[model samples]
Target chain A: MKSKLIIYTFIICLFLTGCFKENQIEKMGIINARGIDKQEDGLVQASLVLFQFEAQAKDITKLVKGTGNSTKGAINNANLETNFLLDSGKLQIELYGKETAQEGISPYLDTLLRDARVPDTSYMAIGEPTAEDILTVQESGISMNIGQYLHGVIENSASDKLFPKVSLVKFSRLKNDIGVDPILPVFEIKEGIPKITNIGVFQDDKYVGDISIENKILFNLLDESLLSEWLEITLPFEPFKKYKRNSSSSTTEKLHVALNTLRNDSTIRVTDLEDLTFKINLNIEASLLEISNQIKLEDKRVLKLLEKEIEKNIEKKYEELLKKLQEFNSDAMGFGSVYRYSKKGKPLTRAEWRKKYPEVKADFNVNLKIIHHGETF
Target chain B: MKITNVIAPGKRIRAFYLFFIICTVQLGVGIMGAPSYIFGYARQDAWISILIAGVALILILSVIIYILSQYENSDIFGIQVDIFGSFIGKVLGSIYIIYLAMALLSVMLTYIEVVQVFIRPTMPSYVIGGLILILVIYCIWGGVKVIVGVAFLFFILSQWLLILLYDPILRMDWSHLLPVLDASLIELLKGAKASSYTLLGFEILLIIYPYIDNKKEIKLPVFLAIIYSVSTLLITTIISIGYYSLENLRDSEWTVITLFKSASFSFAERLDYIVVMEWMMIVVPNNIFLAWATTYGIKRLYNIQQRKSLYILCSLLLVSISILKYDYMILQFTTIVSNMGFWINCVYPFILATLVFFKKKRSKHKGMNTT
Candidate 1:
């Protein structure tokens, strides 16, 4: 009797297992990328890059667009045009338009946070003018799906340490964290192709300004400790004129130098509490890669002079960038975090830090070491 | 009522299995959300709160073991009967049984709710609840030895999931843990009090004491188990506080599960989904042990057989889980159960241990006078 009961129970369980709603892969529209833009009339528009599985199709992806008052509403509006059920579980990236990002992204991020299906690792970026244009671009020489392609672009840059990787979770963490603001990579149509051109700075959730691509490495050096990479710096020709071995006359006013950085580490300290001043120290170990003016790198004195010049140049540029960020009222460098931790009393609030951020002063110290000038030098 | 239980020699288990039993029972649906709940009070100092709770747990476990040592082959129900006499002891024992039943129901409902939110939203609650209860009934059929075996097996199985926390640990912002000792003493105590929910299940030792073969050696395993469980909670809480900002931590419902959501592998993209499904191994042992305690208590207090009480209690739990389908309703039920569990599991033991101590002293005095 007990064996029979066990058999019956097993059979019942088998039958009950089919009660769950089945979602077949072919019948669902797998959303790879989502883009949101704000319209002039204050409505939200959503553009989704969906993976198409038709064997005969030349392209395996397509874009669907819709408009509504909210992000989810806009997505649901887009859902009406497709035969397959739209599923965002496979979403790899999310894009925001310049205007929409300027308005703020916290409202759109709510749906992402509330939904359990959306992965927190999905990359977040801002389109230069509008998310729809970037999502709908038909660039040549790109055979893969556009969404996948965009994800690869951002992922490569992040891995290379050229741009900070701001995933859905990281973005929210920085936005909500006291004494720190969020930064996102900005994409724009350069000529005919979509490209990540700059790093967008945000005050809270609003896009206030951007750091140009040329300054990306410097920005990264200030942001976090980085691995091996290449950096190009230009110095005054006057400093190295005497050391030039060939005495080659050049019309250029500045000497260009390229260094392959093996490692860069930065530390931020609150040096003065009353003056609200912070001191940033950078330690860089690099191998000389290129030089506009050939100098005797074999000489110890010349190498020391090169290091000193490079340090001074980097320090000057860092001061400029810090001033620019102060102007924009964005503490993307997380100076507030260091200040908050150093103080003993009450925790610093975001609003209080924002008010004090403009008056904050910083001193930059760069220690540059040319470990080796490659096999040539 | 008999004060000492007489068991078949074959039914007894080694004292070492208490480690597995206590550890598995303490780690349930509670640890998944314990970080967020405790973080609400202690902030980054939540680990300190867990440490405080651990020390208190060790003291309480020692006292409970002392009380059990005062009698031979006696469990909580038997000792209560000795101290409070028949009627009051039965009433108190029945209340404990009811608490266990409520705890069992809440665990089932919470797991169902998690499945609904994370995996299949449209699936009915009764299906999951009924399925789990069926497994519990099957396990309970094998008796206490089988329950302990399941606990040991599942404890070994579920420990590998701890390795998944490595990815989240890498992304942690060390600065978030700064400004330590920020929470006041009162707040830290309150945080420790909040952890009582997750730190429960060791109370099972009170009833399962009589079934151990080497009763004298039970202390080492039991203490080790509490330390293992508490340290696990402490580690997860510390990781969560560092991985998420204060505001983000506050917003997250299940911080540990969310931590897994960000972990991606080359072969598997959504690890959280796998973790959620694999969590059944963890949840089943909890249900089995709690169900065993409830039914065993019923059998001891009343004359009803364990099998009959198991079936009736499981059916009632199925009905309750189905009725408490809404998220808010499940949350409310969980709050009520944890509050009740706090008092019965943490506070009541000290009171009972004191009563047992004084009763033994008076009985010794009476015996001396009679001689």
Candidate 2:
């Protein structure tokens, strides 16, 4: 019994000896964001936005740059210039330059996916001109670290239904899924500040092209059910000329209308299997926010006319966006997934879907309901 | 050789604890990656395969219970001795003991690998392996009651981790589950076979049979334990198939843990870290139960003290874990043990049940002839 007590004490001491490696917060270079770019000499350049914790430091964050053949190697090279041990556990965002993304972002994502220490929730995006420029942007208007600022920007936009949230896990899912491609928010430096400008579309892992910001809402509506807060559309003035409250108030050829969408539900179905044709039906509920020209809203006829015009405008825009995606040969909207599941016997391979995606035809059906025309009318 | 064990009344436990013992034991390291293994064969229909495996397990357990019920207060060791004469029975019993040791070692090594990969990489394997073995020895020293108590405690403690799976469930893409009957029947059967490893540990029922008081009441608890474990496996597999794309699911080594990795809270950033550590609670019960089975078999078969054999077995296990350092070696070891366990736990029971039935019938006829 006495000897057993001794052994128990020894075991307790073994655990209490602190044998594992220690990682102090002050000594860890917590990387909040990392940007990758391709150099002219075929080297991978990594720009890391590190959180600075030192009380005496001049800034809340610091930029560390390095060049190597791979992302890990480049990060290692950057480590030599810092006293703190680089840790990627708190990483919030990862960005790739246009060139790097065009080449393919899959190779760069290996470190993120392989490292168990890294969180899978980090947002992924593309830098228009270069990732380094976006990470190193010096702007007086921004008070917080660039990495945190960029994360907040993306998170806000995603919550507002401006774009789909693409985290590391989601990106990998889309990249690996058979019939669908991945998309990322594109950030371009404007006047020494980074601004989300477009949606970067991809064919598999390689960036094919981008969709303009004007079409982001339409893209999202087609992708899934969404509740966007604002939408602007221009319609021919000929339709509403008779309902005008003041006849000569404005001579504009087009009437501009703004809407606050309450809800938008969209569904895509295979219309013709042999012809590879799809029909997209969209149901939208919105309240009028503003109208550039005067129209008699009290008349129920005017409201129906307005809804018809808005639906026509949306259908036209949706078709144009679909055409653009087809021209780019990218299936970012997941139409191929619908096509694959709708068909029977045997699964659709990525190659087969790729060959057939560009030739696929789609018809847009929009149903817009004007719930209310604002408090006045 | 004794056909029945005279277990002291003080050492006997109620049959209700079998639910905890069987459920906790079956839910060890195998579950960490069961989804990926089954998914590789069945894809989106992996849940169907898991359900089939569960039903198969219920059938196997019924056979095992029948075999145990053939003799009063007897375990696998005693029954084997009764059927196969003294020499051959001891040999087969020793082989079963070796299988238990391998299972215990595999569970310990897998936990260590998970720690090295997920938590502390630089921590030596001996430290982890030694700590686990010491805990196992400590629990076993308290005898079967302590081991069962540990299993019961840990089973209740670790259940909260299942709630974290809600995050992954929310993120799941339901469309991934479409085209359900895509996998061929043969492929689905293979998938069910693949789940044999995770669905193991219920076979411990054979070893712990004698200690169970009110043996007539065990059928309900034991079957309930299996149903509970099978449902758990089914839910995890469905979640994994829906949450991850097929290629991604195939690539992830520990799909269940990876599912937890994506669960984030405002206060805590990495839930997987907590889960991988809390998983030690789940693993400890598994180690203790297997170690107890091995030591008990040795004592019953070879007339050796359970304490002496336990110490020797644990020391050897510690040394082996330290030496088997490479990832590939650990992988190979796990594959070998799982394959062996599949046959021992799943197929061997039916054969044993048939042999026991014939042996009982023959003994009754001999008695009648004498009369």
Candidate 3:
């Protein structure tokens, strides 16, 4: 009995002396958002937007800067400027400057991939002009937590299909994937607030071009991300030109129609892999929300006309988008991935796909259905 | 020589604990990264690979249990002695113990690697290993009864994590799972071969056979346990395939934890931290049960006290973990052990069952001649 007691005491003492030296939350600089910029001398300037842990702490946001040849070195250099050990457990968003992103994003993102403490769901974006300047902005009117602020900017737009959802996990996976390229939300700081203005397109980890906000919805529609939302599209009021062209006080309000509960399905059929020709079918389902133009709701002819008009408009816009992607040799639409995984295609390397993608032609087929017209008179 | 103390096989256990013991032991560490292992080769067909592996393992496990039934309430250690005589039998027993210890070491180190990646990055590996080992040592010191009791309790508690998969399921894009049956025959064969190791730890029944009561009733529970674990793995793998795109699923090193990140409530930001910590309850039982088996082998072979063997093995595990460097090296170590275990635990049972069958026939003939 006495011997057992001694052994128990020895075991208890070991626990009392913890093997893990618990890192106190107070002594660590918890970074909220991080930004990286490339310099002319091949060094990177890392900017860390740190947040305090205390619930009622007065100064929650602090921007710290450091420069080094590599990302890890730059982070360590940034650590030197702070009084506490720097930590990235709470890192919410990572942004890269235009110069750094165009050169290649894989090198800057490698550290985040290697670090386990970093969350896979953290949002990533490309900043226009410079990421350091975006992180360094100090606005009294803005709610100051750049991490939450930037995350909200992207999250809100992503929900509306204006921006593609680009988390670190998807970014890392897409960069390594041969067929599908990665697309990250790109932002430009405007009027003291960051705005998601364009979608940055990457082919094999290097940012080559961007799709503007005007084309983002169309891209997202083809990508099937525009499902379960309302889309407002404007046409040139074709009926008005026929009816009111002779009137001196003619109103020139374009035809506006709201597509509600919108959903899209895309099918990529590889036809003749030797010829590098693929056919894509996009079928969309939705209900009409509002229409600014007065059209006969009971007329089957008008409904057909409306469907054909929307399909033609989408086909034209998608053709323009496809032409740009092919010119850039970017498979941001994942057409090559769909082709490679299809039953009748041979395996192709990313370089080979890049070469073949420029020559690949897609024939678009759009099917549209409007289930509800909102109690039309 | 029968073990007379509390750790002995004489203390009868319910047949149901067999279900939880196999489950708690096999379901740890591997399930978290199961998708990543085969996703690269199988692509979106990773779930189908998991299903194929599970069926093959169930067939193998049934054969192992049937062989144990032939020996009649005697565990594999005694059966080894009965079949090969004392000298050769004890030698084989010692080799199995070493194999089990290596398996235990891999599971422990993999969990420590997880802690390093997801839980505490700054803390040293040995420290996490030491802390978890201490909990394991306590369970081992209490004997098989304590290990079985904890396994049952942890299995029940950790099951709620299945419900959490619904959040990721809500985001499932069914089109990602298209191009079905695209994996060639050779790719699937290799995938099944790699998955044999993940289906290990059911062989724990070989060591724990004597303790379970109702010898005739054990088969049903064992079958249930296999079905439960197989379906659980299948569900997670299917969820992984549908939730993340094939391009992303292939690179998801921590598949389960990454899935949990998509599960968010209104109040919480990082849901993975909370879900991952709960997995400790599921992981610790694996270490304790295997550690106990290692010591049991030592006591039988060398006639040493179980306490002394436990101390030596725990210290050895601690020392090994201290020297482990880098994340990939931990992965490399576990992969090597798991590959070796695929041969020893998964395939060797079938071969041993055949040998045991021939030995049983000869003994029966000798008894008939005496009659």
Candidate 4:
């Protein structure tokens, strides 16, 4: 028993020694945002916006800039200037300036992707003016500070189909993908606040253009509902009257109904029957939030007119989105991915899919249903 | 006339020796860069490929068990010699030993590259490489039973890391798995071949077969050990896909490490540092085992008696190659290992199995002719 005890003690000591190490950094500084810029001498100037917590002062936002031949070198240089280590594991946003992003982002991104220290889920954006300029934007009022606000704004807009939520990992993936181009929420300085303007599209390491908010719905059709709230469209008197009078089911001559979007479900299927094409099907369920008090609750004629208007509106938007995407050659909606995934029945390389994507057709079938009605108009 | 027998089969191993075996084989070169490599070919479908590979591995393991069980008192080398003529069997056995040694060297180089790329950039390549090789040599200077025992313990301790990073998986977007069947059949098949890389370490079963003391009941533990390793791979693959889309996964080198960077806890801000530290825990056992295996291979092939000399020689070879000019050698080595190692682990075994089965049939016919 005594011998066994001695052996156990020896093992425990060995395990503890392995666990404990010296020269460890106790206090780690968390960087909220990073700004990347390319210099003329083939070096990179990195500006890291780190938020430090102190007992007496307001949250200190320190701008530490470093220049080096590579991202790691720049980071190490910056660390020399700072009292604490600059860690990016909790980094919220990464802003690449228009010039830097154009030079191609793969080299700069290598540091983030290769190192286990950078957070992959961090929001990535392209900055106008410059990333340093965008990161410097700060003001009082609004929901949060510029960095936090911009982070929320992009995340919020992405869910609302107002902008694309491009993340570090997603950007990394698109950087090499041939058929699809990369998209980042474009951050523009508005007064003293960072504003998410539109999605900046890039093809072959160059910025092409931005996908406007007007065409966001088309992209939304390719994604799951990031926004759960219903959309209410006021009934146009001419269309409402035409449908009400022509329909046979209801006695009411004029009725108004507002549709609240309850759910949006979509699926993309690729078929190679005649031409390479992708078919999109939308399943949207809406509740009637408001209706004319004059219209009876059971008015079939009013319901039919509401359905027709919804269908027509969706179809028109779908065609507009398709045309815009084709014009920009933006496969962000993952029509290209859909085509490739479908062909997994027989897989093709990225080179093969690129040749076939331009000739692909897009067909949309939208089913809109009014599942419920409000208590009062 | 005397037939000399220097050593006998069925030598007993201490329970602790199992840890070395489990750790060395389980904590392999796969952890550093598997997610990125597999993700390149399969994309979001990489996780599915990993899952399929895991199931396939389990089936292959069953076949190995069946063959190993056919001979209770002999090792794989002995069984080969018994099943086929001495000359052909030795040739095949030599090929297997050479493959094992090359794989050991390749894994050592890959591990050194990962450390250079991520952990210690300013540290000289030789120092880091030499340090790891020294650690492996120190452990391997013991014996096979001791190495296997240490591997088992190392494998157990390495699992603690999953608990630390469990919360980070919640943020993973499973939609990354969409359009699951998008790839052509050829692409998926190629992806499956790529996926076999992570599943290759189980081939150690063939080499370690002779040393197991409890022949009748050793199957369950060995099978469970393999399943545990595959399960770890599957979980990590799914988490990687969810964290990074297929497009992003292709660009990254260390998907699992990157996944940890996405993780944060209330107490710890950067979980990746801890993950990297945990990686050391995994690498130690793995390096020691591979080094020991290579040492054993050299000793067996050349009929060398001085085992320590073999250990030192194998360690120096690994350290030298690992420190080779880092530009394209590492990449070339990775590509060779992934591509060639696939055939060695996946294709060569089936070939050997077929030949052995045919030889057995021929010998049986000869016996019948004598009757």
Candidate 5:
């Protein structure tokens, strides 16, 4: 009787295993990125890059657009137009239009984060002008595909430390975090080609402003220790200032010495707890990447001059950026987070910190060392 | 009245299965959201709570081992029958058996809740819960040897899931762990108390002790198993704390599953699906062992066959699970269940052990001979 029961159980198991609703590869509209923008009529326009695979062939790409009152509504509207049901299980990135980003991305992020199907590591960025237009831009020669292109642009820069890796998860943390705001890589169509040029800075989810690529590299330095060589600095020195055979010639040509930082160590010292004064010290180790052929790297004095000039320029630029941060009342560098989390710093609310930020004093110090010269030296 | 012959099957478990059994049973649906629960009480110093809980568990488990040593060759049911007369002893054993069934219910319901949340959201809860029980019944049918074998296999295989934390570790903000020692001593104590949920399943060893072929060799492996479990909890707690801010972590449910959403691979997506699914392997043993314990209880108390008792238990379990099908209530009921488990498993084991000491000194085998 027991042996018969075992065989009967196995027979019932075979019959019960058929409830799974299989998602076939060919019939699924695999979404790679979803772009959300606020339309002029105040409706939320959502767009997606849908992947369609061919049997024994390369997959074809398609775009589906929809406009509705909310992100979920817009996605449902887009689903109406597609043959295969939209599956966002593979969503690689989420892009927001500049205008929509300024309107705030927290709403769209709320919908995405609520969906267990969405990957938390999806890259987040603000597309200049509008996310719809940016999502539509495509090129085959430069990029393998638009999603790969767009994702590669941000992912590459993030790894290079030009911008922080602001994913849906990290962005939500920064958004809800008391004292710190978040930033995202910015993309714009430059002469019909999509490019990630700068990062849009936010003050409490509002796209207040943006920093240039150079300033972003410096901003990233303040935020975290980076091992990258994307930081290239240009310095003009005396040797190339007047490269004529005779110094008396009085004709001067600039020696544009370019050095890339190979490694950087940044530290924040809360010098005074009362006024929230901070001294951000950056120790940079660099190598000569490019130079005008006039100056030689073998000369230690020349390297010293270049290092000092670069350091001085970095300090000046960083101070200017700090001043700009005060102007915008932005704490994207997480200074407020640093202070709030620190043991001794007095805790304050987000509004109070933002209110007091303009008056908070910040000092900048950059110490650059020439770790290696170019291939010649 | 042959205690060892009744519990021990022809195919006995080796000492190594003790390590995997203790570790596997320790981890389950509780780990899915344990960090947040512990953090809710202790905040960033929750890892310290796990350490304290581990130390306390070491002392408590040693006490249990000492009690087992007092009984020359007996399980908890046998010991109860020896200490008390058959009528009262049978009643206490029945209560204990019901407690194990409730434990089986709680474990099954918790995994069902997780499955609904992460995987089959639209599927019927009864179907999912019933399917899992079927698998548990299959494993339980294989008896203790098969159950221990599954635990051993899964313990070695599931260690790789820890590697999924690499991406989150890279992205984590270590400052979140700051303000260390911020939670007071009392809060840390409450945190340790809250941690008892995840640490509760190890006491199943009390029932399965005699089946251990090398009882003498069990201590080092069991101690290592506790160390393994404690460190896993410690590291996962620290990782979750450092990965998400305290406020966010508290606000977030299923701290571990939510963290798995961030795990990315080149070939796969939504790694949480993989995690929540592969996590079933770890949870099944908890159900199997508890179900076996209840069945083993039936065999000991009423002198029925183990297989028949399992069918009755799982059938009754199916009805109970179907009745408690609502997710929110199950989630709420879990805390109550864990508190009860803490009493029954952690505190009461020692209490029973101390009772054994008193009963032995007072009457010894006098009650046994009369029974």
Candidate 6:
């Protein structure tokens, strides 16, 4: 009787297993990238680059555009248009146009963040002209497709210290962290071709403008409190300047100088309630890359002049950037976060930061050290 | 007679009951929310903390086994009464029973909240509560052996569904895990505290100990069950950390559940349905085990029969508590229960071991003096 029951149970199990066989696919529509922009009709225009499965063959990438009042609505509309469901979990990149991002990505981000379908680590970028332009970028000569190209651009920029790897998850944290403003990869269309050029800066959710053209932005910022390793930018020095030469050169000689990032290591000394001074050390390690007017290769006097000029340039840039930050009331440099995290437990909210940031006195000290040159003249 | 009658099971049921107990108790409500909670405190290192917790569980269980072995065939109740005189022993037993009841209530409430919030917002809490209660009653009515057999079947089936989760794991970015040694000590501690849920249901050994035929083999299976649970939790943590990074996992409420939904199978777009469906296999036996434990506790403490009286009392309490407190109040209540259960389960085992040892020492000394 027991043996009979066992066999009977096995048959029932096999039948039940067939009944509940999951309708799972061997391949799924993987979204590689997404672009969001605003339309003239006040709808959010979303373009998705989907990596389509091609059985036994390499995956084919396709673009699908949907429009609605919001990103979620647009995505829903797009889903309705396709036989295959839209899956954003594999999405590696998301591009928001300058105007759309400025309008506020918080709403769109809310939809993605709140939705379980969207992966949290999707890299966020800002596009110029329109997100659609970047999403539709196609070149006849390009070996890799547009989705791969766009992803490659962000990856290359990050590797070159051009911008930070700003994941959607990290953006949300930095969005809320006091004093540390968020930065994203920014793409601009030049001559109708989309290219990621600068880092899009944001104060909370609002676009605060990218870092000025001079100082290279690292994809991940080093702790501003420590004077660790800094980037060294070498340039040519003028002959008339009081400096030593790294090498003998034509009056217009190139200087092989190393410039370290020091404004990053600026100190925030909170003396009293009334005075919060940010003493910036524009400490740069430099040498001559070239010289327009130079003396001898081993002339310490000539090299000093080159170092002084390098010092002056760094200090000037630091001051200008600080002034711009004060003007914009931006804390992207992380002065606010440093203050809040460093000193005790009390954290200043957005309101408190706005009030105190302008009154803050920022002192600049440019320290120059002529470390080495590429070779003797 | 009562004990033998309650423990009787067909040979086939023995394997299934054990499997059911292990899988259901191990999976519980923790799998849904644990990654986020543990991640928040430990940051990326939460996975490390889970592995550490698993080891801690193994050690705790080993100690429990050692204590049980001292009495040979006696269980926690019999040992307690023998060691501490009946009055104090019964009081301690009552506390244990009440603690299990409270824990059962908390797990039931947690499952309800998860279902209401994620699966069905419009569905009443009692729908889940009523369904679960019916299943638990049916399992217990069939007796322990049958329940274990069912658990064994569920465990084997659920393992099949887990293969579908591999797609998301492949896309994991390990770079996001940089700056590894970053979390504050306080945060790591908080993460360890949140891991209490993952380590739940192991305490059911207190009741299940007497039912096992071979006391010697008991240690290995129980230890292996803990190891299995820890391995599952560790895998879940690694996947959550790999899929979302620490920052994202920290902010998410139902991190694992969300991750499951994020993937699309070629045949079906809805992976969340599969997850919720599999969770039924987990929740059913888990709910039944907790109910059985509560009933067992009552039987031991008050000298009530295992059937009819103890089971009915537990059913009434679980169903009413599960139904009546369905809203936000359930959240407040569960936090207290989980916090209390952690103390009762993790620490109480040690206390019993100490008490038993002390009594044995005293008796040995008296015998020596008499000689």
Cα RMSD for predicted model 5:
3.8
Candidate numbers sorted by lDDT from highest down: 2, 1, 5, 3, 6, 4
TM-score of 3: 0.89
lDDT of 2 by residue, B1-371 (tens): 57799889999999999999999889999999999999999888898899889889989988998898888889998988888888888998998999999999988888899999998888999999888888998999898888999999999999999999999988887788887788899999999999988888987999999999899999999999999999999999999988888898998888898899889999999999999999999999999999999999998998899999999998999899999988889879988888998888889888889898998899999999999
> Which candidate leads in TM-score?
1
Model 3: CA > 4 A from native: A1-28, A53-59, A138-141, A158-161, A225-228, A239-254, A343-345, B2-10, B39-49, B166-186, B235-254, B300-303, B324-336
Question: Least accurate stretch of 10 residues (summed lDDT) in model 1 chain A?
Answer: A157-166
Which of 3 and 4 is ahead in TM-score? 3
For residues A170-269, could you state the per-residue lDDT of candidate 1 as single tens digits? 8998898888888899999887678889889999899999887777788778766666667889988887778887766665679899988888888989
In the order shown, the candidates' DockQ scores are 0.80, 0.75, 0.39, 0.31, 0.49, 0.12
- Compose the digit string of candidate 1's lDDT tens values, residues B15-63: 9999999998899999989999999999888889999999999999998
Cα lDDT, all candidates: 0.88, 0.89, 0.78, 0.66, 0.79, 0.67
lDDT of 6 by residue, A1-377 (tens): 99999999789867864543242443556678889998878999899888776566563777888998888789878877665567675677888888888877888888778765566556788887688887777655456656677777666642444555677766766776556677777877655455667667787777768765344432232322223334444465444434444463445445544443333433444444447777655444444454344445466776576567666666666667767777777766666654554454443577888788877776667666666654754
Task: Identify the superior model by TM-score, candidate 1 or candidate 4.
Answer: 1
What lDDT tens digits, residue by residue, belong to model 2 across residues A345-369?
8789999999999899999999999
User: Model 6: residues >4 Å from true position, as ranges?
Assistant: A1-28, A54-59, A158-161, A218-236, A239-249, A253-274, A279-316, A361-377, B1-76, B79-251, B255-333, B336-371
Q: Which consecutive 10 residues in model 2 chain B have the weakest lDDT in total?
A: B171-180
Error of 2 at B42 (Å): 1.6
- Scored by TM against the true chain B, the candidates give 0.98, 0.98, 0.94, 0.87, 0.93, 0.89
The fnat of each candidate, in order, is 0.73, 0.70, 0.42, 0.45, 0.48, 0.06
How many clashing residue pairs are found in candidate 3?
Answer: 0
Tell me the spans in candidate 1 whose CA falls farther than 4 Å from its real position.
A1-17, A158-161, A247-252
Checking candidate 1 for backbone clashes, the offending pairs are none
The DockQ score of candidate 4 comes to 0.31
lDDT of 3 at B164: 83
Question: Model 6 chain B: which ten-residue window has the lowest total lDDT?
Answer: B1-10
